[model samples]
Target chain A: MAVASARSRGRLEHPRRLWVVGVIIVAAIGFLLAKGLGSSINYFETVNQAVALRSSLGTTTFRMEGVVVRGTVHQTSRGTDFSMRSHGVTVPVVNTSSPPQLFAPGRAVVVVGHFARGTDKFLSNEIMVKHSANYVAAHPNRVKPGANGSS
Target chain B: MIITRRQARRPLTSSSSRRPGSLVRTATGVVGLASVAATVWLGLWVTPPSTNLGQLVRLLYIHPPVAWVAYLAFGVTAAASLLYLWRRTRSVVWDRLAAASGEVGVLFCGLTLVSGSIWGKATWGVWWTWDARLTSTALLFVLYLGYLALRRVPSDPGTRAKRSAVAAILAFADVPISYLSVYWWKTLHQTGTVLNPQRQVHVHGLMAWTLLLGFCAFTLVYAWLVAHRYAVEALAERQQGEGLARALAERRAEGRAA
Candidate 1:
């Protein structure tokens, strides 16, 4: 009688084991989908988007992308001060962190920081350069020092 | 019967029968190595630096080519898996080819991520990011790795091949998603230079030629790797079959003596 009951229990456990495994796999996939999609939906906001949502954002740290306007870069005691423009909207940025080697005027960059309290200036601690796909060979005579307008 | 069987196996194991195929594989390996060297030399010394990116643009020659090879390897795996699944075209050859291509694809995919990370650090100022393009590519690498792991689960050949073929097909669904992620979402990673949807060419002159050469060279290396991997798989399968036969014969002989 014990042997019969044990055999029946073993058979019962087989399908249950499969069910448990299936549920675990489904749950893992669901979690990954949610996490991956949720984070990537808004990887970074453009300068226009950031400005439009500034009030609701309320000084929270986030990444913002824009092109560095030419002739607006200034090196200050605190950090580099510049104007980031996108879609005709320009936002003044004060980045405390040192910018990358490629960071210069007319280059696209993503700055990681937030808006200063009660001020229009964006306070950034990190600057990342974003280069385009265009690749043109440099002419020997045309390549000049500080041609990229780095501060 | 045992002596006769052993004699028959001896010829199959001999090198003479495989001489022609071995010669072709050797030649392919040699050419692939030569082209890779030429690409390195041209990329480093001959090709002029870009006006904007300067010397940093040299990484373009390797990164794009490695990424292209990864895509090609997965594409072949998908095609071979489909052949294995189709009733009219089903064969063990297709299954082996799919497995070989998948392993090679994983290797190239890893190279892609590493090379891309280095390039990103220099240009984007970040070693890694969770943007759509980067995330989807990382997912692809993990998915194929899972597929390879699934193949190792102990099972009979027919059942294993069928399940692995299904898994290969499922994993291949991510390739297109990864390729088009930049277009589908606003990504930190830049879009394709040569294969963009706009049909525009961002590279020019000697740089263009070197990039093309890199592609051809890496592709040849991929072919050589897959060929060697498939040969090894075939040899392993043959040895397994021989072992099974030997064990079965021994059991029958004991039964006869009893």
Candidate 2:
């Protein structure tokens, strides 16, 4: 009935109306998607960059990757405090929960959190340790509750 | 009575036992099975654990390709939609293709999300995050799901096609955002190591081969599924059309009797 409908609906008519209306609705949605991104987008920054622009960064959360500095970690039942360093710049990170198994010092880690206003301290809600591809158990005690180091 | 008459006249309306393309269907099933088998074998057995992620990196072979196909399916939908809207190319076939691709896209999109969540839980110590990549991907999944739902709403074929075309185009706006989320925002997700010029290829040797194989297998599987799903969509459309014709014919006979 495609042919039937086309004939009855007058296939000869111009389709300017449809084209115009579609463009308007689509454009409005696109605009909203773009505009709302500011609140949602969290940029990744290095420790050096985070500190250099701590005043400008304000309350916007971000992720920063660096190697944990040895002897700068303190663990507690309530939370853990550590410092991450890269290229001579070190950023102190305070996490609210037990760090992942590989979160020890001198290992590469990514901290997901934000810096307090006017403070150099980086407060992290989550910390992701860089795991190496070698199927070796770096620490038998620290491996995730159910995961093993072997295939 | 109308259904009986219709079914008798069109025995193949939805029957697959004696489909015209039985050989092709068999071939597709074989290929699909082979792809899945090979992907699992290589991804699990052949490839070494990732250099940094160890066993958790196994998800890479599956996650990336599943996401790739999800994106590919939606991209095909967007292209088909564009063709459907163009006056010179407007046709029910294009609409059918768009509908088929959108459905497949949603399926793969769901798989991608699940696989990604598992990978995240293994590596990131969490199952889900509101990071840009994940959040934008979730949005893409919902948008396409909405597109599928819209297709189900009662409407004439012409209106359905017109609305779906616009919806597909609108939904595709999220694909790029989801893809570029890592670069565009600060997120827990890692940037694309393969495609990004700034990053070097992280996997080498058998790992690279296995990853490549995973991508090829999934793509072939997607093609096979799309071929099957499109045929199903066409059959459903035919049944609807036949039902309408039957109703019209019944009304005409009543008018003559009156």
* Best model per DockQ: 1
Per-residue lDDT for B74 in model 1?
Answer: 91
DockQ for candidate 1, C-alpha atoms: 0.28
Clashing pairs for predicted structure model 1, backbone only: none
Worst 10 residues of 1 chain B by lDDT: B147-156
Task: Give residue A60's error in model 2 in angstroms.
Answer: 8.1
Candidate 2's residue-wise lDDT over A1-151, tens digit each?
4532322222212356444544554564465456337434643577888778778778778778787887988986669998898778998888897787545667767788898766778888888765433332223355453243211
Candidate 2, residues B144-217, lDDT tens digits: the string is 87787667545567988999899999999999988888777766677774555465665666766677777888
* DockQ of each candidate, alpha-carbon based: 0.28, 0.16
- Superposed by TM-score, candidate 1 places the C-alpha of residue B21 at a distance from the truth, in angstroms, of 3.8
**Deviation from native of the Cα of residue B133 in model 1, angstroms:** 1.0
Where does model 1 sit among the CAPRI classes? acceptable
Stretches of candidate 2 exceeding 4 Å from the true structure: A2-36, A55-65, A102-108, A112-120, A130-151, B1-22, B197-200, B256-258
- Candidate 2 reference-contact recovery: 0.14
Task: Choose the strongest candidate by TM-score.
Answer: 1
lDDT of 1 by residue, B197-236 (tens): 8988778799989998999999999999999999988887
Global CA lDDT computed for model 2: 0.74
